[model samples]
Target: MNLFRLDASILPTTSTSAEIADTVEAEWAAAHPGATVTRRHLGTDPLPADAWALAATGGFAPEQDRTEAQREALGLATELAGELERADAVVLAVPLYNYGVSQHFKTWADLVIAAAGPTASLLKDTPTVLVTTLGGGYGPGTPREGWDHSTPYMERILRDAWQADLTVIKRELTLAGTNPAMAALRDLADEQHLRALTAARTAGRALAG
Candidate 1:
């Protein structure tokens, strides 16, 4: 088994989302001993700027007319697409910024979803786990609930574009000034997220067997 971990937190080493992602990787490694794990850090090591243009164009511009920049961009996009195609399971550690996923994660999504022909579904039916860290909770009836777009958007994109079986585990209310009770609730939520990942792994193994 192989698990691909994408760390989308913009913060250096201090990001809570990155911490959660590390924990998820640890848990996954524990559950599947000897399994291969690949990590991509998008915060500091962003894909080349031209990668987006290549993804949008579906390929490199005409070779003879292609500028050096365009060629570099196409190369980056092809590399990213290759990584996405090879993963068996994907784990994304996404931090909610202004109620949306980081722009880096979105860019990766755009490239991977741009594959051609039958390879377009290379990510289809793959198991995906999303860990989102937010400043405030977004469950039903919570204040600012309507602004909650991370999980729903991810679900739709994974299902519609990649055909992934998506599972989301959110840790919210990490900001200061929240009531102690609410903080505890958020911790509980994180724990539950771990449990959910365990279950998902078991199910995936069973299906493979």
Candidate 2:
């Protein structure tokens, strides 16, 4: 089994999303024993700015004058596609920034989804897990619930474009002083996320077998 892990949390150390992803990866490795996992860290080295510009234009740049920037942009897209094609399962660890997925994560999604084939065909039927860490608490019934677009948008993109069966695990209220009673919520959330990843790994291994 091959697991593709994408980490898009900007924070280097105290990032809850990254910590959860680490736990998930560890759990996945433990469950699969011999399975291989490839990790892509988008926060450490962001995709070239030109990639964003080219994606916005929806056109490939001319080859004769193709600067390194242009090549890097295209390379990012190709690399992402290649990884997706080779993996049996995908895990995305992202932090909600202003009610949306981090820019790096969005860029990665755009590159993968831009392929010409049917969204589902290009992505195959890989199982996907989305883990998001938010600064404040907000759910389906909260007044500011509409601000929670990260999970919903991710679900729609993966399901519509890749026909992926996605499971979402959200960790909310990470801010300094949002809810006093929920002080230890982050650790609990991490435990739950680890379990989810373990399940995904088991399912992937069974399918491979």
Candidate 3:
């Protein structure tokens, strides 16, 4: 089995999303033993911001008439799409930044669409897990209840657009322990953290099984 793991955490060491993804990956690793795990760290090595535009425009141009840059961009787009097609499973650890998906993830998604076409289900029926975390609460009645604009968009892409057999794991209020203003929420944050961790292990086992 081959697993494709994508991480968009700028702060890898302290990323709550990554912490959960690690558990899922660990279980997959243990189950597969010698199976392959392809990894991409978009935060540290972001894709060229212009690649998606180049790839999209290049598609309209004849192959022989495509510019060198266009050719390279298309190649990268193809590779990104191919990764999804080749994987038996997928893990995407994405966090909310400014209440939306980060640029790294946006670029990656654009590239994939550039290669696979907007309607293509590259991960059709593939078991995929998306781990997303937020620093503040966004549940009903919370001040930011509707402010979270990341998770739903990704759900549209991964579950609806990509057609993956997707599972989502989420955690919020991650800053309660460190942010002075959120001190009152520390206890609740702790509870949420443990629940997220437990959910991670369960998701991992399900992925492996």
Local error of candidate 3 at residue 47 (angstroms): 0.6
Best-performing candidate as measured by lDDT = 3
Better of 2 and 3 by lDDT: 3
Ranking by TM-score: 3, 1, 2
Candidates in order, TM-scores: namely 0.77, 0.76, 0.98
Q: Please give the lDDT score for candidate 2.
A: 0.69
Tens digits of per-residue lDDT, candidate 1, 1-209, equal 87888887777577766666666666667768898878888888886555776556645346777767666666676777787678888777788888887788878777665444323665687877777777776777877777877767776776666777676667666562356656656665666556655544554443232
Clashing pairs in 1: none
lDDT of each: 0.69, 0.69, 0.94
At residue 22, give the lDDT of candidate 1: 64
lDDT of 1: 0.69
**In candidate 2, what are the lDDT values of residues 1-209, reduced to their tens digit?**
89888888787677777666666566667767889888898888776655756643443545766676656666667677788788877777888999887788787777665433334454557767777888876877766778987878777777777776676667766673446666766675455556645654554343333
CA-RMSD of model 3: 0.8
Counted clashes in each candidate structure: 0, 1, 0
Model 3 stretches with alpha carbons more than 4 Å out: none
